[model samples]
Target chain A: MSSSTPHALAESLCILTLKSGIWVLFPITVVMIMVGILRHYIVLMLQSPPKKQPRAAIREQRALIRSQIIRATSANSPIPPTYYKSISQHLSQAFADGTYLKDGPPKGDAPAPTAPNPLTDPAAMDGMMAGMKTQMVMMVPQMVIMGWINFFFQGFVLIKLPFPLTLGFKSMLQRGVETPDMDVRWVSSLSWYFLNFFGLNGLYRLILGGENSADSSRDMTTPFAAAANIAQPGQAQDFNKLFKAERDNLEFAEGLYSWVGKDVDTRILKKYGRLPGEVPR
Target chain B: MDLTTSLQKLAAYRPKQSQKSKETFEKGVALLEHGGYLKQGDEGWDALERLALAALDQDNLEVADRCLELIAERFPGSPRVDCLIGIRMEATESPDVVLKYYDELLEADSSNAAAWRRKVSVLRKMGKVDRAVEELSALLDTFYTDVEGWLELADLYASCSQYVPILLISDAQNLMSARYTYALQSLSHALLLAPQNPSHFLQFAETAYLAGDITLSLKMFLTVVDMTDDDDGDVSPSDSIPTGMTLRAWFGVKLCTRRLLTEPRLLTSSGSQTPAPSSSNISTLDDLSTERLRTAYLDIKNESPPATEKELIAVLATLIK
Candidate 1:
């Protein structure tokens, strides 16, 4: 109808001048800066230093970490065969004795790898709290700024990007601005705000270092999130079973020099032009 | 050779000038003979294995028999005891009997790395290179992370080219082994999966040089040469390199320096090599020279270079920046 409306000629042109780019850019830039500042302070207030564990607990956790490392990096030369067996056997026995177990063995046949109630664990709760805090820092700002844009610039077609996009993105690009016939290349205000949010990762990295918790786009990838996911509530695996699996893995581990155990020196010598046999024989 | 005299010769050939008497071995034997290890489970088993093997090697069947008895009595079902039994058989039985014994052990527990290792070595001793290759492959199929199996497989290929078993003692035999290009692929895997072993770098450098990858070889060789100088009380003295290791590194550096100077880098390959040159090449000509490495080696031997793993890493990290 606007195409044929003669009296509203100048307004009906609907051509956004290049100067209007500044209006969109100014708002987006302000939103990005505000979001970043809010993100830092909120995350700071939310953070708590990891809870200090007793010495025995520390030793037990370290033992688990060490065992895990041994399993992961067994191919590395640091864990010779002797070390492999000794650590596995000691841990296996300790696991059997329930030395570091918080509670008595549950009443069941071949108990599950995890304890039944990780939700009750203080450590796991702490992890969940941390995860929720990071998510809050990321989601709350985008939502607030998006609401602001919707309230003020609901129908404004901010700017057309240099690149062409398919019509499949129309629902996304012209979200609040229900221009049924507008080109997909022309992005609305809310859509342009999201574009800056996702595309400014490199800029954020340049200013905030590679591992800032403020990058809401990276919410799921933060170490806190990962740790929380791993320590799922009511889910704790049995250390006994863990030790057994590790023992099997290590038993089969190839000790790079174990084949000819004592012949390591002889093998090297032979490779470098020494005798295949003993040196002084 | 007599075990005492052979050990004495090894000590002499070592960079350290320490001399050993027959008493040291006896003292070690006496320590194990004590009942202390019997109370400790894992340590007890290891001590028993060590004593048993030493006793077997020294032809002291009585002590070996006692150690083996203790092992069997303590850990009745361990594959380790079975492995000790296999070693005893290798020492006493015929080749075919030992082969059959290992096969039976493998049938009982295919995942027993010790039995599998003994089987491969026995196959190699019998000149069954193809079968050894097959068995080694099977072993590696289950355990690809092991560096030793890769090295052994590489050795098997090298042997196929010119395997003069008796020539293994001669210095000139290096010429024969260096020509096996087939092992280069396997060595690449070794280099990729190699961990914190500085010796692997030395070995890889030597093999790479033989394979004519002058750039990678030079980089690895320089890394080896640098890593061997590590000593700041941080690393255990047991890991300290003797004079021989440095001399071998020096030979590689000298060859690398002369080759880099005489060779045209751009012409070896196409435009691919031009875009990125070796970091060692970009380093100062003084750093790449044979004289500098020799002087460095001498300083290590004489003044004791205050190099730790951290120190050399710092030096290497700053190579470009």
Candidate 2:
């Protein structure tokens, strides 16, 4: 019994420290959850309804859909030969004439022009503003909370984890605490704040359902995503070039139409075991 | 059933246009007044929408108004709710009033697809089919992925072909042909949008038959039959009769084959541009379709009540001969 006295004292000391640490841990966690919920509502309110495209833009898109249909169906199926001929001819002609282009036919034989500057386009500017607004909504609360944790709870050791960790984790788990001899399992208040920031993602999903904007981890990747979209600006493609490419594709598919549709009636009859010459497999 | 169970059933029920709307309305009203089952959860909103439509169908304007009011209060300024209000008004208002309402909705939000479709339908209901066609075409230009829109356009064109004034025979023929050509074009779009559904192929085949292209019609009919074959090997060879859609396709095949046999001119004329199947092969297909149809009717006669046999035999006689 005398040999166990020092061990008991050390265990009790650990428990006393952990009990004090609970104050810091509990408040930071609660504040994080509340801020996440508020941020979700704020983002929802900030989102704008999708804008409608002009009639010419819609026509340009659907004309592409029509050509895509012809290309897809003419390969393996039995489209009536005359129907195929008329549709393919009409589409190729429309593509060549630039009838479906949003701005109508090109003005002159000038070489393909450079893409318009994104900063000059009002629509592109609006998109950039919207993206920035969402980023600010996500970042401001995080930065404020991080600064708050660093200011007041600077070196408070919040909790001691039950499992043992290597010496490498001492720096991560005791962010502001300066005791080099302390156990790696003792998590300081600032480290606790960071943990709650990332680890409450599942909790947010539970409270707000699957598609809520409360997730902070997703914001980590948005900067890279926005960088990729910056090149496209307003997603304005060159419709004349697309239409010409599609026309070439449809012209190529005309051969497929002729080959597949040549003996459609006979092939169908034979497949169904109606033709006398061959038995259906 | 107990109140809770019956309410659950009502919540799950999705009423189609051809269902017994009056009965559905009564049941839904009873549940709403007594149990308050429709005040719960997301499914409750769906049930409310269905009940509201049923109320409109039954001409219970008061109930429809109450339902719409509740839905609007819950989802304020929702485009779906706005469309529901438009539908409720369509039950009672003049076509012009309803058209104005839809136009107002469209003006507020120009991308409201339901509002655009309703406007076209109102124009059609007022018997201005040409105007309806023009509006629907414009709508499809924006909503190119709307398979229902394409189908509705095809139906409108086919209906136009039906009502040609026959006094000017040559002009009527030209107009009829042009209408059919447009209908075929629309159906082809629908087919492309939903390639996996067999019904579009069936519709295309029937339209081809109506357009006097017997060979194309026959080929399309066979395509439908092949598409719905299942090939699960669950079919016992002795008792097998193509059921449902396949059965319908077989009947279409029989009709097309018989027509071609009687009017060989149709086969030659349509087949001149493409290679026509030998006449012998068409007769063979005709025999095969007739035999399959006979066995199917016989199977149905055995499975059905005895009283239906006389009627079934009468139908079979007309169809087979």
Candidate 3:
């Protein structure tokens, strides 16, 4: 094989080899597609319904949202000045007093210097378990499929591409095949399986709608990225700190606040050239 | 319409205040009875829920029960479905039963917004207005961005104001003003959340007018007129007549201006904190509003019968005079 040119060696492929290559390619591709469809349904079945947060949790979230709204709308707020002052003062006082804390004030006079262990909190543990379950649902089938392909099709050259590839692709396209003299276009079965794994995303989207969970490419990267997050997934927010931050935001907004509707009569009059000696400012 | 088309239409139809519930119930039942919408998947469930509400509205308890049963079977132990069950109970059962059901649902999921709102409505329906107000205020504290909740709270406050008797003039006046103040505050929150909606601004203006702040009311009315004014800049101010909310706002502007001119002390009064329009600006606004009202009335007169046109013209003459 080293004595022959790559072009001539590619042309010399026998009928039996090509037939075996087709046999290796056909079942893997079909089984992969079937597994993808099955995985979509299985993930759907295994997914848990979203749990509603408790009342205090919702109030904490909405209180933050209300402060953000005030910050965003302060420059051109339509709320009158008196009402604006009262609500802002009320929110600032509430935030300082921890009136909207989810689990109430800390037992001690001060919050702990370090965050509490999330694993010790039952609610946080439940959240982590939920995250882990979804991660498992996404990951388990992929490992099984990869392992099956590796076991059954080890060292098998699946197919050669029509277009020539550079020598740089040899390690990627000939993963289990160790022959150095083989043309770079010759792909191993495992390499083909990896290609199908990443490339079938669009196919799944075509078969299922856009929101289907069949696409497993993200699972490859998410496990490592989410490992650190899984320990404290959506742990109870520190409302005291958040409230202090929002109080500062609301105080900062007070200096910038101006009611947009304050001068509407003159503004509209000037808009239609109705107000005397005034331009449409 | 055929079964498929009518089913699709009924499934997609959103209920509005003016929608005929009886007709909706009939159409919804005709399709839903045989599960014609089942193939529509999620939309079928939506149609079922809407039909249940329509059936409840029309007092068709049997059909409503069937729809609710199907939905509850599909989504067992769901808070949303539980709220729908509570609403169904509200139609037939006493207020106490409905309230208990809502309380149980809330106990299961405290943040169930629908269940909380239903509990408040049940309290209101039972003529426990103060209790309803307390519950609703607490609900709003949690669901601060709920624009409809704020509007409903404002309406309840207004209703409370109206319920005060005139026999105790001083107490009624004080209580009435206090209630209107609360209503105004609630409406202000609604305005903060949805500033682009002209109707909220109109509501604020009307509430301010009722609260005896003619200055603030006039400004809000003018804001509404500005918001709803759709004509391009090319139309001369004299040639353009306001319509719809703008027409209503023009009437508001007329009312505010008349009151302000008759009692100019409303501007200098300590109770009215908003910056007042000048006497000259008020007179000009009055003229502009009167001109617009005259054009709107004349346009209406042109569309009326000959006999009513004369009467309308006479009324218009007296109105602008």
Per-candidate TM-scores read 0.41, 0.86, 0.87
What would the per-residue lDDT of candidate 2 be over residues B4-56, giving only the tens digit for each residue?
33322332232255457777788889877864755678777777777888987
- Which has the better TM-score: candidate 2, or candidate 3? 3
Candidate 3 TM-score for chain A: 0.83
If both were scored by TM-score, which would come out higher, candidate 1 or candidate 3? 3
Scored against the true structure, residue A126 in model 2 reaches a CA lDDT of 76
TM-score of 1: 0.41
Report DockQ per prediction, comma-separated: 0.01, 0.37, 0.57
Model 3, range A1-281, lDDT digits (tens) per residue?
78888656654653346568789798888888888888788877866566678898888778898888777889988877888998899989988878888877556666564666777877567667766766786678778878887898787787879999999999999888777777888888889988998899999999998998777786676765544565543555667888898888899999899987788878777766787766543
Top candidate, metric DockQ:
3
lDDT of 1 at B129: 76
User: How close to the true structure is residue B47 of candidate 3, measured as C-alpha lDDT?
Assistant: 81
* Each candidate: chain B TM-score: 0.67, 0.84, 0.86
Q: Per-residue lDDT of B1-321 in model 1, one digit per residue for the tens?
A: 443332222211211212232233355477666776677877666656666666666667787788788778876866666777777777778879999998897776555556777788788878887788788766654455556767777767766754434544365535454444445544534544564566666776676676565544555554555555544545432234334454456456556545665675622532112121333333332243333443444455465333553343334223212
Chain A TM-scores, per candidate, are 0.68, 0.86, 0.83
Off by over 4 Å in 2: A1-19, A109-114, A221-233, A258-281, B1-17, B34-38, B161-175, B236-239, B271-274, B302-314, B317-321
Top TM-score prediction, candidate number: 3
Q: How far off is each candidate at the interface, as Cα RMSD in Å?
A: 16.2, 3.8, 2.5
